[model samples]
Target chain A: MHSALRFIALDWGSTRLRAYCCELTPQQELVLLAQASGPGVVKIVGTFSDVLQQVIAPFVKQYGELPIFMAGQISSSIGWFETPYLNCPVTPQAILHSVCERISGQQSLYIMSGLRYQNPSGDNDTMRGEELQLLGLLRRYPQYLHGQHLVCLPGTHCKWVLLDNGYVSWFKSAITGELFDVLLQHSILLPKPATLYTDDWATFTAGCQRALTFPNESIVHALFSVRTKQLFDAYTASNARSYLSGLLIGADVGSILHDTKVESLPTGSIILIGSGALQQAYATALTQANQQSVLITEQEVVLAGFAAVANQTLLPLSCQA
Target chain B: MHSALRFIALDWGSTRLRAYCCELTPQQELVLLAQASGPGVVKIVGTFSDVLQQVIAPFVKQYGELPIFMAGQISSSIGWFETPYLNCPVTPQAILHSVCERISGQQSLYIMSGLRYQNPSGDNDTMRGEELQLLGLLRRYPQYLHGQHLVCLPGTHCKWVLLDNGYVSWFKSAITGELFDVLLQHSILLPKPATLYTDDWATFTAGCQRALTFPNESIVHALFSVRTKQLFDAYTASNARSYLSGLLIGADVGSILHDTKVESLPTGSIILIGSGALQQAYATALTQANQQSVLITEQEVVLAGFAAVANQTLLPLSCQA
Candidate 1:
């Protein structure tokens, strides 16, 4: 069992820290043995080392001093140690070579470097944790490594990564999630009595269709439609909430489709990485835009990412079998 | 003096109320006798009548029960009287004829109707207060009454009204100002310590240029660039704030330019109604978009709007001279 154990993976972000005790089978498949979570870097009351120990205590107690791999904001400027972002057109091997290893007491901890891309237009965009997921995607589906693909990871700041022949060529980021949150909480677009959002796919699809219909219009206009629709169309608070989500997600998807000329690309070439409601919304939006997309759960990708990195850097030669 | 005095014009909105005491000269010119302001409809603690009486006390005491004409949120469903919106393509005469009158004790009050437009695509947009301003524009510059014109009113909700041959053809409202306020106050893009915004024209121009360059991309993506520029390019909080304003304003202007094909229209055909920093920012954005605009102050337009409506509805035939 100890021989089967590989490394502990930590997905630490702004709000939460998720720890996965991972193992590699003889067939080289990654498996999650145990998992734990706690407050993220921003929410930590005590020292990061102390919080880290507390979070991984049970796993450490079971498997003594396994190598720990950390991703996300854990390597941000405010994290335990700041790691430099690797410039884009980066490959998985290039990312593996750039890992910053630190000795924390008796534990060997490795922090993954993020990716930064400066487009031909000289606009700069940076992502910390999603690089590992992209790398994991490459590992899981080597077929993607040989082709040009658009990989979308939806979150607070949704990222659209362009992969060209095994390299991360460039990417764009959208503030869709954060804008939706701020608008829902602070703007007049928010319905009174703050209705909790429920799944209303029809309303959501309508919003997506509205956004798609006006591909050239600023989203600020569509956002105001959320208010006008409620006033003139008798949209309830729940319907408005669902519709708002769809408008934002649809705009995000539509921007990529318009900017990248996704209609000209082969169908199902766009890969979406997210889970649950956001994934469903993006899928619906893509469908509304007449674009096909392949969906992958975020958890699957992140764990596979950690395992792929661990296999390259931590797993012994004997484990290669 | 009382004989020369005309109706009092109230420009009451969500935040504040301003009352303009006016007189029509024998030469048919509108003269401002005095002006006063107080909390708007949303901030009124007491009855609308009490607030109105208090705000217009000096004028009423001086002139002895002059007819009062009110516009803005004061006539909305949430305001003192729920005045229905006049549908487009409506004329100023139609608006005056639709005025809803309510007698408050000894005082007679007339509430001006708002405008609601449904485009050919069946999208709805509504505007209060600005309808009067649009009427004022026609009154102040009768030349605008004969041709196609785009009138922009930049405020919390920026309004774009299309006037065709003396009728308010249709209009579109962008939540640009409200979005900037909400984003600056609540989003991750907000610079720390909450920097007070000052004039940073260079930074603002950069943002406008960026937005105009990406006319096909969603503003959501450009919004994320605000954070990225701060992270990678070392932008100050003030710079970020100014840049954000430009981005929103630019996107708003770009949408109209693209949608209306403004380049095909006569130059300087767009009339901008606003004042202060917002007016300057919008002017700059319009200039950046290569579209010329004529400027009008909010005070001038609202007063003219109220005076125009009053001249039609409240002024007796004896005062027509």
Candidate 2:
């Protein structure tokens, strides 16, 4: 067998699960061997063990008895195995150390721990798989390790993390994506047979501007505009959908800009971790909020994160073996 | 037939349909003859006409062929018939004039038009049944007819209306109730088998304070605290629900307090129109925002509105007859 360290990395969230077969090179480089996906933790029909077994079967056949590192909702109570949440100001090493391990069949599985943050007012906030992404970001861009930085992970529960000198200090989570989905599907904002959202940048920008203009007002009041604009024939259903997206993303980004703590930070470009349409949408919103943003794909960060974990744990073990 | 002018008043909304057999006396008194309710326009299984017939069967048996004055979602496109929305700075008489008339079977049905308001920024807002509530409030409290007053009708789409000398000068709709329901039922904030929301005023008040404290922030950020508090064992599932309610209601009221236009108005006790728990909740939130609120039942205001319509349209025709 080759001396290179090998392991499987899993990004299992609420709706989707992705498994990456990875190898750590001699020169401390991480390369993806193969990747596969299945239903997420929530979408799994059978037992989690059964779903995990099936998802990792192909990877196991090629690389027998490899250690598997799982992230995302797969570490929550409803996930495969519940893991502890490490309190912030947490480090990537602290997160790796807190990982819960169990042997499933013949494979060693490690579930990553999430981070919990308490604001000054004593309100608690949390994130799971995204911590790995933040860690990956830190690994990729070491410059952030010595300075204060802001990283936003936009997803079902969009997260805004404060990275201070390499520690995940404090973070806030916004239910932007979930709220948009719920409002479009369930609230009166959308017409019957939900309108398919198109990439109408003009309409989206207008929504962002509206949200930014009323930075102090609750979005609940502004959301009705979605329905009203459609009712008045001022917006197409598709445009309305896009506008709703813009409103939510705008509000999310706007709040961060309006945040006194965030405002106090050195006006640095926010590190946005995500890809495709959502990332673009957030970037547009951040620009509207007059904040600069740097984009990093989810795949890149998650891979870098798993590689960090692999280098810390598997490399040493493989060398010893 | 009796000389008194008689009509059937309908408060048909999305979830429930209410019909009042009403008589306008010679002395201009509105008397409730009888009342019945059925599934709302959206809940009707077969047809709208069929549902209306079933809901008003008893009222019809007692009052004979009376003109039906319908308000609420019954005037929307999805209702029995779509009525035009009167432009804002609208009065009760203006709304009555725009009523769309149709004969369903043997009943003379008059579906009241909703009111549409366009703010200075050209954003449009429309309200259907709540306009009747506002008109009713105007009739019940004529003092509001000559001065600036803010009237809040809290419901699924809570309406914050500005009345300038009895004209509904402008208004805003916040999806507070709808958002609360949707988030509790569909969002990750709640656990599976959804937490039953109970009235825990202390926890609720805490939530209200939090929202009011950060009046400028989007609630999407605050909402995740509901899950975190529960996860941390700091809040029970029930208390979390109450806190969620407080946050939404606080945000709604906070926006009004923070609104420059609303702030410029002479200080007066805001008139609150609704009944039961929602009204009480809003009153509490208003109090938390340090604003005084005067309460009126929804039934009283809606009935008054229908009476105003009957006095304007039905009484004159009956006198001629």
**What would the TM-score be for candidate 2 when compared with the true structure?**
0.95
**Each model's interface RMSD (Å)?**
1.3, 1.0
Residues B1-321 of candidate 1: C-alpha lDDT, one tens digit per residue: 214448798889867798889987656578999999999765689898888888889997898778888888788766888789889999978876777888889777888888999988787999889988887888888988898888899887898888889999878889998899889988877654566677788889999999898898888888978877787888888888888988999999898788754445565547999999899899999888877788889898788777667766755644555
- Model 2, span B77-192: residue lDDT tens: 77778888889888866865766778877667888888899888888999999988877787788888898999899988899989998788988889898899888888778776
TM-score of each: 0.87, 0.95
Report model 1's TM-score to 2 decimal places: 0.87
Which candidate ranks first by TM-score, i.e. highest?
Answer: 2
- The candidate maximizing lDDT is 2
Model no. 2, DockQ = 0.81
* Cα-lDDT of candidate 2: 0.86
